[model samples]
Target: MSPLARKRLGRVALNAAGVAVFLFAVFPVYWMVATAFKPNDQIFTTSFIPFPDPPSMDHVSRVFTQGVAGNSIWRYLLNSTIVALSAVVIGAVFALLAATAVARFRFRFRTSFLILLLIVQMVPAEALLIPLFTMVKRLGLYDQLLGLIVINVGLTLPFSVWMLRTFVAAVPKELEEASWIDGAGRFTTFWRVLFPLVAPGLVATSIFSFITTWNEFVFALTLIGDQGKYTMPVALQFFVGQRSTDWGGIMAASTLMTIPVLIFFLLVQRRMVSGLVAGAVKG
Candidate 1:
């Protein structure tokens, strides 16, 4: 084959591979959405039926109105929101301070501390569940959103700190030096000059913490046992019963649960590009 023809064929092959990977990644999400919208009878009737025939709102209405296995989904959603937001708030502050300290100072065990954070991230969360649950119970925090928040904040903090450290370290030291020359205090220099540069990183970290905590299930399930205290994921289990499963309601609930994360991503989408550029250029 001619070189030009081979190059064109290679381009087509690459495009096809890209499309295949995209579809593979997206298929599950599409199926979930499709299943949620499908009527009960239509679920297993045909794989090709991508949407509900009559396009009913019954499942959605049921999710809002009916208490699945005696659990209030809306209340659980509120619990999830409270836990996730609180975790993100507390995690971000701790991460910011820790990141700043690590980035600016040459302290003892600094390298070890960074390495420890990476190691912790490598450990599977499931392995720590039992121990964490026992600790939470001993502390009288079991079944409370406060306990969940505390655990999530701790879990997400290390990575957040590491990420922010990179972003902060990337900022020019000369900028801070110039600020000090102009008589800016340490706090002033950090807040005025460094904070703006790391703003993107902070936002990125917040999003990560929020999503991780929001979707977290194992910890939530083990820690919070009461139906009233359940987060969205735990509450979702109510849809499955020994006798039968409420496919429609499950889908509707799943769909509803996904909206907040989607909205959060959409809101931050504009900042994401700017944040990446800022962090990259400064670093």
Candidate 2:
């Protein structure tokens, strides 16, 4: 093979691999949406039906009108949204501060602290569930959205701190020195200089926190006692019975659960791109 021919062949192979990976990731999403609209016969037939013959909204209609577990589906959505957004906001603040300290300062046991965060992350959330439940109860936050928010923040904070530390450290100390020479105080220096550069990392971490909290099922299920307090993941349980499961309803609910995440990613992706360009221009 000539050099140019080999190069072209490699490019073609790379493109084909990219397309295959894309389909692998996206096929499940497409199947879920299709199943949501499929009629019972099409969904349950022995042979495969790739597409719904005539799309039906029976599941969607029933979800909206009948509600779940005697509460509106919208209520559960609102609960999940509240918990996810709150967790993201609270987690970002603490993570930013912690990352700054870790990346910027020298302190006793600093290395140990970083290692401890990793150790905490490696410990399964399920193993900590009972202890966390006890603590939440002691703190009088059980069965509240606040409890879920606090749990999520704790769960995501280690990763956020670790990820953002690199972004923070990538920023040069000379920038802060220059700001100090110009009479900018510590808070002003951070607000005017460091924070803008770190914004991209913050947005990236926020997306992770939001999606994790939104899709979290075990904590949400075990922490809250009230039916009305359930998040969307927990609310989906109502569609299942001992004898039979409501596949259409489950798929419909899952599709609905996926939309907010998609929209959030689209929004965050634009901001991340813009932030990167702005940081580059500033540099």
Task: Name the Cα RMSD for model 2.
Answer: 4.8
Top candidate by lDDT: 2
What lDDT is obtained when candidate 2 is compared to the true structure? Answer: 0.88
Kindly list the per-residue Cα lDDT of model 2 for residues 99-131, writing each as its tens digit: 999999999999999999879878999999999
Candidate 1 global lDDT: 0.86
Off by over 4 Å in 2: 1-24, 263-283
Q: What TM-score would you give candidate 1 relative to the actual structure?
A: 0.87
Taken over the whole model, the C-alpha lDDT of each candidate is 0.86, 0.88
Cα deviation at 91, candidate 1, in Å, is 0.6
The window of 10 residues in a row where model 2 has the poorest summed lDDT is 270-279
51: Cα error in model 1, Å = 2.4
